[model samples]
Target: MLWWVLGGAALLVVAVVVTGVVLFVVAAGKSDRVWGVDDVAVGECVTVSGEDEPVVRKVSCDSTDFHFAVALKADPGVCAAKNYSRLWFGEGDSSDSFGKWARDGLCLAHVYQQGRCYHLPSSKETNALADVREIDCSSPPATGAGENYEVESKVSGMPECSEEQAEYFTEKPTPTGYCLRLLE
Candidate 1:
């Protein structure tokens, strides 16, 4: 009877240890924070504009560690009032498309620096876009460096292109109806 009791206690301890380890692993896999537009404020660092929830991050106004910075936040009603120019998202070449956008509606974003040296955005998907190095618009860009847009504006509907911003517009509009417009 004494041996049996010791055996049972050892088994119980082992089970408890295994359960604890499993719980810790699961918790670690999940992010501690999830951010949304409502969670951020003006002048905060942000993934360009999109509806898709980005892969769980802690967004803050004080930090510039992220991609594009938010100068203004707009909805379907107010987005048009703030934008000066627009470039259609997904107009980028086949090399630029990460994956066929498979599912989920898309969002458009354009980067604009003060010097007007914005580059073509590689992806419309906020979570998928990689290595975006946004800089302050007040400053000038390098003599022959890459693209950087300071303020990101999520536009409404397929934007009308003009000589002022872009020479052409998106051939493929987003299923959601709105496309990202950026400086050329």
Candidate 2:
């Protein structure tokens, strides 16, 4: 009887331990799972697609496909004060519904990794964010294109970049900016 009781108790303990471990592992995996645009929260990374009706999906910050980090999820006008780029939830809609669509969108900021090179949009380009593209630092510059800029440092608010470096500002939560220099 004693042996049976001890064995039963040990088995119960082992079961509970296994259950706890399983639960922990499941939760950790979910945290890294891709989330829908509406479900994603601030500080999470996302990739934007589709020009007509831009599709946004949450992705791991460290993922190679990561494009932008969510700065704010609110009306377009609310983001005007900040330096974030806007992606309306319902773009290409009629002018009558413009206000409603503008009220539902996400404010995104580029994920400017240090030492990476990028080709920024020209002043004439209407949609700056859509034109921003990453480039290989080792490769030669593209023909007749704007100069490629390499991220030198990232800082909060407006960065005090040198004369050779240009300041790229964005608002993730508060004011944040980056110092970029021409990629030679």
Quantify all predictions' global Cα lDDT against the true fold. Answer: 0.38, 0.67
TM-score of each: 0.35, 0.61
**Angstrom error at residue 8, model 1:** 4.3
Which pairs in model 1 have colliding backbones? 87-181, 87-182, 108-180, 111-149, 112-149
RMSD in angstroms, all models? 11.2, 6.7
lDDT of 2 at 38: 70
- For residue 101, what is the lDDT in candidate 2? 49
Candidate 1 residues 21-85, lDDT tens each?
99999997654342344554444344443343233243443443443334444432232344311
Give the alpha carbon lDDT tens digit for every residue of 9-75 in model 2: 9999999999999999998876633333476778877775544334456677776542888888886
State residue 12's C-alpha deviation in candidate 1, in Å. Answer: 3.3
For this target, which candidate reaches the highest lDDT against the unseen true structure? 2
